[model samples]
Target: MVLVWAAASLAPGAEARQSAFDTRASHAVIMDYETGAILFSKNGEEPMPPASMSKLMTALMAFEALEDGRLTLDAELPVSETAWRRGGAASGSSTMFLEVNSRATVEDLLQGIIVQSGNDACIVIAEALGGTEENFSAMMTERARELGLESATFANSTGWPDPEHRISAADLARLAQIIIRDYPQYYSFYAQPVFTYNGIRQFNRNPLIGVMQGADGLKTGRTSEAGFGLTASAVRDGQRRIVVFNGMETERARADEAERLMRAAFTEFELVNLVEAGGGAGQVEVFLGQAETVALRAVEGLSFGVHRRDRAGVRAEIVYDGPLRAPVQAGDSVGRLEVTTPDGRIFSVPVEAAEDVNRQGLLGRAGTGLVRLIRGG
Candidate 1:
């Protein structure tokens, strides 16, 4: 039973109803998944207790450790008395049902925390990463700021509730965005159905997983004080939509609104191919080098979510200072490719030099100069 919120607004010129999901949440926000651009937001920037959303940051720190090869997924983490006492079945909180003094692998613990909202797993992960929960909370805050999640602080790895442990829906969405974008491999764990530990079956709490198309995985949080909130991301036909809601009236409502927003985004906003990845909108000359000139292409690819009716009105332009000086690397940013609608909303895409161009050496310079002199002397 997904109780969707009333959409209170829509993007300008969009055909769909521009309604904001009427959330009882003290705060709510809707955003473009790909670019972190806000579509509609209310109290989106204010810090509030994140509940289990704090686990998202916990998982992210673990992921960063994994990415840098500082930790391995198969590594075992010892369950401390503090972690076990802080969580588990009798604690009236989420758990992988871990036993005190028993150990679980990093991968399994991650599944527990993300899929099951296991506070036990959160503490275990924090201990494994930073030696103690307090130190880990400090690390989480530092990393949160580094990731641009400035409106957040981590009082505990599990978000068990302290006055200072707070985060905004926008910051929560930002953390989710990084999880999906940077750690593609481990991020898949968020989509799993359940994490079975010590004979207990704990299902993922995210509601949009199976019901919504391309809604693979993300984290969800709920507490009486925090009301009901969710951070959801969905991908459709290569485009992604991310939405976060806090102060929703109910869990089902949060899920329903998430699905509705994603569907609307994919339906109303379509990415038209402007340029192929590593392909040219055009070419440019190199002042001096092994090559006289080289192709310049978008750093990634160029695409835009133009309203279906406005596709024909889209315009693209490459802005550069001038011809590039040689000694350019293959992937050097020389300029920006701007995409604008007839109405003038714009998206700036980066354009990069396609190949390296070495500057002419003294001998090479003299040879070129002598030839020029012979040609025009």
Candidate 2:
């Protein structure tokens, strides 16, 4: 039987609900990792200086180089005068405290960049990979475009104050997603609490790690122009959430708001199972076939996140082109099942034929056509 589901209409009593979180940051976004749902957003798309948080992109490039065998964890790269003069202790920015001519392994640099927010480490990687910091920033911008981050523009690898350096909270969240999805092996470095270098141990600057439950790797940012920012991720019950917030007044506020938003994203919403795989959601008429109708089922199980209070407004609809023709086979693509939440997010799953239906014989076709004509079909 072809299952034809009527488009669901919004219930009269259903009302749209707003997020309860009142964030202190100037820009913020909370997203569900599995469903691609935006739990909350405020100025999320507006471009602003990413500050040290831009190092995530720098780290992504290094991870890519490592994966491609262009670099290795134990391989040591020589520190350049430019890296020393511009981003080193003399530059008064975050540094790994490398001597002018000292060599450091790729692993140590990555740890320095991630744990200590070392600007010098970023510059060292930039010089090692692209031969110059300018070239590396340009490469970062090109890679951001390839990654579909339209709002991201890199002026420097360290996220130093530059009028042209900018990225949106949404883009930061997307960047975090790519890092987690693409570089799982290297991502553990982000969670490291401390890295001892040159006999000096510095704790990871990320606020969420260790303080928030299930929180793992990510980065933090701060500059006079960008204020304070954080790109954080956490996993709970097998579900991960990504959050990016910037332009907070202080470190404490950034930490508090980030943790609050992360908790709310996982707690306020629920994963609702809408349709089970291989189960018929509805049926549709079949023309000139052995069976008069055919059932339709989602090719896979369908589920989505819904706000607990707004669950009443959530609706699902099976959408297909038309009444199917004969010779239908099980698993044939038919249409899509769409689930819409009260907040206006739509999640779609493929619909398929539940069973086979052979074409009718000549006489059977004629009889069916005649019956259909009498019924004014």
User: Which candidate has the top score in TM-score?
Assistant: 2
Which runs of model 2 end up more than 4 angstroms from their true locations? 1-17, 271-306, 310-377
**In candidate 1, what are the lDDT values of residues 1-377, reduced to their tens digit?**
11111111212233333232333557765556776665445577889988887888999999989989877989998999988888887788877889999999998888998899999999998988899999999999998998888998889999887898999987888888888888899888988877788887877788888788788878888877786777878887777777777766787887776666566666655555666677675566665576777677777775555555555455555677765777899888878776555334456678788878889998887886788789993
TM-scores for candidates 1 onward, in order:
0.67, 0.73
What shift in Å separates residue 275 of candidate 2 from its native position after superposition? 7.8
Query: How much does candidate 1 score in TM-score?
Result: 0.67
The lDDT, on a scale of 0 to 1, for candidate 2 is: 0.84
